[model samples]
Target chain A: MPQTIQQKFVHQVIGHSATNNRLASKNKIGSGSAPVNIALSKYWGKRDATLNLPTNGSLSISLPGLGTKTQIERLESQNQQTDLVSLNGQRLDQDNAFAKRVSQFLNYFRETPQTFFKVDTENSVPTAAGLASSASGYAALVLALNDLFAWNLDNKSLSLLARLGSGSASRSLFNGFALWHQGQQADGLDSYAEAIDTTWPEFCVGLLEIDVKQKPVSSTQGMQNTVETCALYQAWPQQANQDMQTILQAIKDHDFATLGKTAEHNALTMHATMIATWPPIVYWQPESVEAMHKIWRLREQGVAVYFTMDAGPNLKLLFLETEKPAILQAFKQIKILEPFKS
Target chain B: MPQTIQQKFVHQVIGHSATNNRLASKNKIGSGSAPVNIALSKYWGKRDATLNLPTNGSLSISLPGLGTKTQIERLESQNQQTDLVSLNGQRLDQDNAFAKRVSQFLNYFRETPQTFFKVDTENSVPTAAGLASSASGYAALVLALNDLFAWNLDNKSLSLLARLGSGSASRSLFNGFALWHQGQQADGLDSYAEAIDTTWPEFCVGLLEIDVKQKPVSSTQGMQNTVETCALYQAWPQQANQDMQTILQAIKDHDFATLGKTAEHNALTMHATMIATWPPIVYWQPESVEAMHKIWRLREQGVAVYFTMDAGPNLKLLFLETEKPAILQAFKQIKILEPFKS
Candidate 1:
């Protein structure tokens, strides 16, 4: 009473059809929005520059509406032509630096594989003033391309590609709390971002802009200088790792004070490493200093708010919705700083 | 048969004569000038707060002619009624904080154990502004009193006494390159400052004043806050030790580059620890930030100047005599910063 060959053939057909159904769904053009993520536990150094493997793990959160939207479509032309790219409705010149980086990123797919594509992206975030516009921009590109090319890569695999474009971009794939693990492998096969939670109690990030200009030294280059010359540079990875764990625990335990406190400490430590570098790259403006004191004043008043900054003049204030009114009122007194929601 | 009693008595007579001659030299009322010493490798934390024993060693240089002139005279009466204290020729109240401190210091003198004395001091340095006026101020008082009271206290023992009043004052006991060792003792008998060199090639220090007001939190209290809560606090002692060694070697080797680089790094690391403290005691003002950038800019222009700030708003710039014209010309551009020789 053994099963017949026709029955086995019928079972294989069922499995093949289900697989085809999933792939076919991704056959058409696709678009997605990837929000910009702010690192509460920052990622600074790299273990492998070529593979984009971080030297330490980091934790970040996505500002739900502050991000980029990218639309991508596979071109039918098979002449091995370049991927046509347009940013903010402008056709980027092939010789433009950003366009070249975008094309190079597209080439990373299968290493000279035969599919040309078109990419269009627009951002709702700041460009280079350290709000991490590139993070959200590249994250949107990877997501849209993953959908259009039918590569069927999972979110983690897509994150690996996103990191090649920008390091912080890897964490932008997730919605709420995302952690990019600092993998030890040379190939960075295990280094990727994962979503911790899709939602949390609605939290608002107030951006106190000090300057909106591009820096002379980019964050990547600035970090390279820090790694080479800072005497305290050797201590960053271990401290950041410990900070990541403490922050992660704070998140799990639902302790906002511990979370905010650790976030501020971690951010300051990151800047401390920079300031210790020979010729010490200082990014803080005079107004930024005043703004920080104001935040401290707010905390002194028992306002349950904290602030962090990246490699730029803008200070990001993280607090719950309940504390917004007091924070807003306090910052309003400062003539220089404009507190805003993104 | 080794020696006759007369021979032994002769040896005793010579010793007594030498001691008498040393004390006899201070037959009249005594007055002296002790220049203020600025720490290059700063002393920030204390192991024994009551004794003013630093948690780490420090190195400093004394500014000649920029200090206090203290005059001390023993009273003729047996009243022990009051030790008159005057600053800048104005008699201070008996209940004044400084007068109380001076009386307490006089209590340490064993030579005039029951003697009430009068003390007068005048400061040419910025008091309580981190230019270390107290360092030179207290140092002058101790040196003058040590002479007038005929205590026969060596400079080493006197340094310990100065530390009881102010920590950095210990270094002011020496002329230049004074080092205060952080000793591991409960009573702090072993902690004292020693001279590395009595004199060196004349070097100038440019004082960039940020504010002349007293700080809200004193250095002692600020450091306590750092030790209690800063996550980066533990790494400070080890980093400071290495920096001290490197800087000490640089001083011996006469390598300005190594000295300047390590000094700047060491100072920033200390601030890093403070910045990580809960509620983070930040001592830097906005102009301080600008002054730091200007130093980096000056170095980029091939100048060999370095900066170190203690727990105050003034920044001390150390450079050779050759760089004076160039530094003065550069600082003239900033109106808020008044750079001057100490």
Candidate 2:
């Protein structure tokens, strides 16, 4: 017979006051928020797998208005062996890596082997659209767990813990420019996040999602292949380090030209590294290349817009909020995006 | 009823009495020695059609003991329309571009009209290899003409004339380390060759002729495509300027590391620019990429070797003569080179 740990905790807390009462009556509730982060400098490879340490450092900006709202509650139930997790009221299996990592972390402090925990998450941001849905999702989970357990850990500590789950998840803990320092330590204990500048609330990043349907190779596998097979991967570390310093300085000086140039070069170099790998891989679809060219042509024609891409086919155009309509109009002219425009 | 204005000069040059005796004897004598030049940086684009000015700068080194030897003898002929041009005693039509250009230049001086030139030529270099046979061929022709006419013009002046025929031909005039500066001026008159550190005789370049049957695309068309469409070409001017400065300094300092790095980067950047052009052309064959990787791997394994490619699939490995056998062995392992072992 499996002794129910939740029943034991409840019995110890309320002295078996209501045996007939549902286990949901004795649950703990918490709410948390997470922000969407845009990577200023992209990270493409991993240096260490066990700790999820990046080969190159990256910078990101955490947006204020867009994020995930998550709520979690631990319930006492008659069902003991079953682990139930729900996202926005939809049931989720416990086998998920993200959920497993979270559950493992929780089990470390609880000192009780609970078979399962239910997590309810609501993502306000678009799911899987390259707007960093995972960033917000993971961030909200970390924050919600922190609130439920009354853990007074700082955001940086939470970020370090979150990094073990997803590399980009750490950036969402802060609402500003975040730099993930890839420390050269064996244990990766020193690797953590630091802020470059507070988020520019007025600055808006316009995303032109081209509605790509195919799933991309996960970042973990893609990066591993590049690191192992890319002839140019060894040279990338020095260049990326130099670029990081220059881009940080540019951001500090508000030098948009330098920032955009660095971003574009870094993106191109990343793609070059991919091509240099054995059995060369390219993230580019025809539309992706065309979109880049269009953006470059528009910029050359005096449009004040610059574009950046993460590990997806969608392009993110950085511009002033006032320039949004014009940028949208230009994107609409592209046939691929025409289907998506209202 | 057209008068032959060149009767006096042609009689004086060939000696009419000797011409009549030669017709009876059927004997021919050829004059002048012209060296073949190989482009080190590789010329692959044209800037001006009329002048045959290159879009980007090219560098070349003269091949010792190889090239075409030709002799031209002026003959007085009564035929006004017939300009007899013979190569090794066979007559060639004067309507071709080669003949037309040469005749046009000669006519610009108004030195002689209605004169038939008997030409005899022999080529010692390997024909149709990526070894710049055309460079040697055209260079020889220009030098032979200059020598025959007693033009009193130096090799630089001769190269300017040669540029009107082919771009790579212009780089062949100098003995070592020549640069073809693509002058920004419209007339391209200022565009000429300059020698960099003519004293570096210790440095030697070896050609590993990976023979292929087909001819590569002409450099003139490649450059036009690159200029019209390559986004990376915009960065080339700045990069090339920096590389030129570094390479010059390295040659002066006798720093092999600097020389090798600059050369490798310049070659790789050139190829990168080529691929970035619209419709994506690649000078690299499977063997070429394999050869590059082999050299790179060898270098990583502590071999002192570097490589550069011209406008074909064949590779040139620049290394000390003593290390040539071992490097060739390494290339053989990759199946890039055939067994050359004795």
Candidate 3:
């Protein structure tokens, strides 16, 4: 039988995080929010399956307006410790796939034996819509629970904990650009994401919703399969590793052209790995492809814009804020778009 | 003004062939045939646009029965020295795209400014239908003209000549598996295809024609665009060079699995390079993706089969002869398939 999460963590927790006064701890509710991360270098496969460590290093920008707000409330005493997860105000079944995965991560945070908490995760973006909703949700939940237990852990520890929930969540701990290194450590101690404080005032995100529903194959599963198979992916690691350097330098220099090109290519590289896998995973729709082509056409007409996609058909168009009007005009020329400012 | 091609290669032709009795080389028709080669590792971008040299190497197998049989008849008389080209019984205008390309190649074979020949090309493969008809058609036309004038050129010289007409046409000169090497020379003199003559009797080609229309972007234009852009392709040359060695060894070792995996992966890599281009050149249709998935699914069920694609949406599934029935049954399961045994 599995031990209670508090007992599991007592033995597993690393040094330096001292517990607060246990005697004074009482039932309380705490709310925290985290923004969705828009990956520039792209996080695809995992290196450590148990810890959810990434296979390739990545850099991401936080979308301040889009994310999840989760309220963690300590539940009343019950016969059995059971964590409840509610998404968009609908109570999900405990045995359902999403709830089970959430519980798996939550159980590791159980600080009190025979104690449970209710997590209400409300998303500013569509849930599981390839907008990194789970990354924000898990990051927010971890943040809220840290307050509930009075565990004032540093951002690194918080980021690591978020990774245990969703790999992309590691970057959500930071406010701006964050780099998640593909660490060499087997224990995942060195794998946490670090925030890059620099900001570009002109950087803007253009979200074009080709579809809002969840992808056919989730990013986690897709990455796992691509890593195991896909021969073209044999070069993806070295390729992306070099791209990271280029994109990082571009970002530091505020070179929008170089940054946009590198980011766009890196996303395609990730998608290529997915497409080269057995059965050839594809997330592109006719409308999505059309939108990308229109963007390219707009660039030909002198619009400074580029695009990146995760595991879904949605496109995240990155451009300078000054080009917003041109980008909007280009979008107007394209039909079937439901745009949200990323 | 662009100089006529005859002036370009006048000194390059070897002098071994004394024209067989100048009087006997009259208006009699001569025929030569060559098989269409199916690329396992695809050729996408061009390193030298002027010489038609590919940026990446590719491996291919021949479809012997599906090819072109052209009849070359020396013209009785002509004042300005013209090469009238006809395809599939249609007398194509000299200024038409295909005819112009053929004329450009035929001009290189002109022994004298006044020498002229009429070329009639017939193709077993579909014309401009992604069936590589131009490859076979050009190969046969070049072969027949070589016989007509008794040029007695070696296969390397013939392959180079064919490439001037169409890039992939260079491979069709071979009887079995052929590898096209993207040589390092700037002048493209060393860039030519070599025939790997080993025959795998068990090897079979399952052709599925998804569509026969002309590609949205011609192969030449697409390759030039990809080589100019697609940042992910920065590593493609090295990746493909390595794949070339592995695939060549697999062919020599008769390792079908290694050959299949490398070929399939290489095709995807080529497609990735295209997809990563500025506007993203995509060739896949819904049915084409469905066909690829069905092939992968068949493999999961223990059928030793793999697939490759060219610039168009058609699929060429490579499998052992022993698994033909199983492969056909799986194809039957795939809807919208117009199967042709190559």
Candidate 4:
């Protein structure tokens, strides 16, 4: 009997001893929680699509309060042929897109043909609104799985498993800053995120929600299109890698100006590559542009506020605690989160 | 006296014989008119700023009705020590920014230190509103200069002179389709635009005016900033050159699909480079983003409409006559013009 490529990769990360422990689990209920992360240096353009290996390294900051909570338990009856999944408080049908994806991920962990899991998940943030629920969701799920099997794998091992679910999920395993290393390998065993271990107590993130609806294009598909069709994208991986290093240095030095400027530039460059794509993926709506202009105006008026955008139209602002009053006055609806503070 | 680089280039284009004619002329009034041209493949970076040599070739379509009309004559008295410039019906002060730029350009053709010109220019389109009035203004001014001196120089020679004023002005020397060659010479003698000679009568341009006020940053400065600070801009010149050939081929083949797609992608890529620049150059307003979404929506509904943007917020839409009804229905304020038609 030969293990699948994914199984081989998983086994390599957790070792053959842990692989054996998976079959020893039966009906133990395990639960875990994780936080969403906003990328300061974005991850885009995968080197290996199947393995979700990024072409360049990325850096992020996690919001501790806004994230996902999940619980998992092995099904007791052999008659249950499929995994039962629920979101928030409602049970999701197996045919649901979310359930289907979760089931596919669970396939990597099934001990036997008759083994099934009942998975319950809840998101503190809006799902699929580019708050990166999948990052925290998959991270929490991997932790739950780790607890269920009693593998006692370290955070790095759990991050590797989380990355197999979503590329950004690797960064969500940590509470503060995390750096996802873009490993130079074919098998992608080295590609995982670890905590940066630096915390800026004054650092703040302001979420300006332009739209909560599902994005018109998924980041996965948008990145693929950009990598395939955007000629300007040829320079992105190099710039992104450089930005990652700059951001890491900024975090270590506690240089807010360098960090804010580099993060904003990195996000804009990522969006630029998407804009240069053939079908032209423009995530900016009228409100998005308006928010950008507002940010620019505030900057012109001597405010130190800067912003970074994801694959969706929402903007996540970066500013120190000193500018909180100005940012609050300017954006009345902004949801402010202090990442480093309790 | 040693000639300036500009004077030497001008002499090389018009010949030493025309250089003498420029000096011999005194009081003859010369008038010329030219249409503003919209670039299908944008000219963004410069290899030589002194000679206005571009980094890549470009393609454009001339708007026959929207342009500049200019009249020029040498000052008869030595008391008139400065070039007197005016726009529309108002006489501009010698210290005005527009007058200063024009006088600076006219210095290349000055017969002597005391030589001066009275220039009156009128633009049918909005000045500095991203309508490219500068392209047409420079082209008409060059033509008026040629007429004043009775140089009898061809359009190619005139285009060389106009390019010294503004890079896009080289294409404005011809109606219909034109291609500006990105010459590979130290002196920039080979960099001139010529008529493409293939016209699609059904080709239509719809102007979506987002703003008519003065642009915050000039295209000249914006191009320089992008070239200098944008890391992603390394791939731009090659993509722009390739797009030039593709657009030229599309014009010859009368393939509207290929032409529109390439032109829009080129424009977006150009903007992408600017966006990736440090201190990011964003030309889109809220209305501009709204218009872009509208254009994308129209395309999703099977309309063949596409748009191109310059360094300002306005959009120049491209579509065939068959889609005119659909475009008109979509954008009520849009002003449509046919390049090949009167």
Per-prediction DockQ comes to 0.34, 0.04, 0.25, 0.91
Instruction: Report the C-alpha lDDT of model 1 over A20-124, residue by residue, as the tens digit.
Output: 543355557767679888899999888776666788999998776778999987766777477888888899988987788787676654223566778888987
Compose the digit string of candidate 2's lDDT tens values, residues B24-99: 4332332566566655455555667666666667665566666667676565556655445554445667786545
**Chain B TM-scores across candidates:** 0.83, 0.76, 0.88, 0.97
Cα deviation at A17, candidate 1, in Å, is 14
Give the number of the best model, judged by TM-score: 4
* TM-score of each model, in listed order: 0.82, 0.52, 0.77, 0.98
lDDT digits (tens) for residues A1-342 of candidate 3 = 237443343324333343443224453877779988888998887877877877788888888777888888877867646788898888998897877887777667555556677888898885434586888988898788766766667888778778778888988987778888888877676777888878777788777777542237877888889888765667678767777888889889989999898898888878877876765677776566667667767887888888889888878888887888888777753212111233
Better model by TM-score, 2 or 3? 3
Clashes of each: 0, 1, 0, 0
lDDT (tens digit, per residue) of candidate 1 on B124-187: 7655335667788878887786677455677777787778778888889877678888878775
- Model 2 residue runs over 4 Å out of place are A1-27, A94-110, A199-202, A333-342, B1-342
lDDT of 3: 0.74
Return model 3's CA RMSD, one decimal: 5.7
* Candidate order by decreasing lDDT: 4, 3, 1, 2
Per-candidate Cα RMSD to the true structure, in Å, reads: 8.4, 14.2, 5.7, 1.5
CA lDDT, every prediction? Answer: 0.73, 0.61, 0.74, 0.91
Give the interface RMSD values of the models in order: 2.2, 9.0, 3.8, 0.6
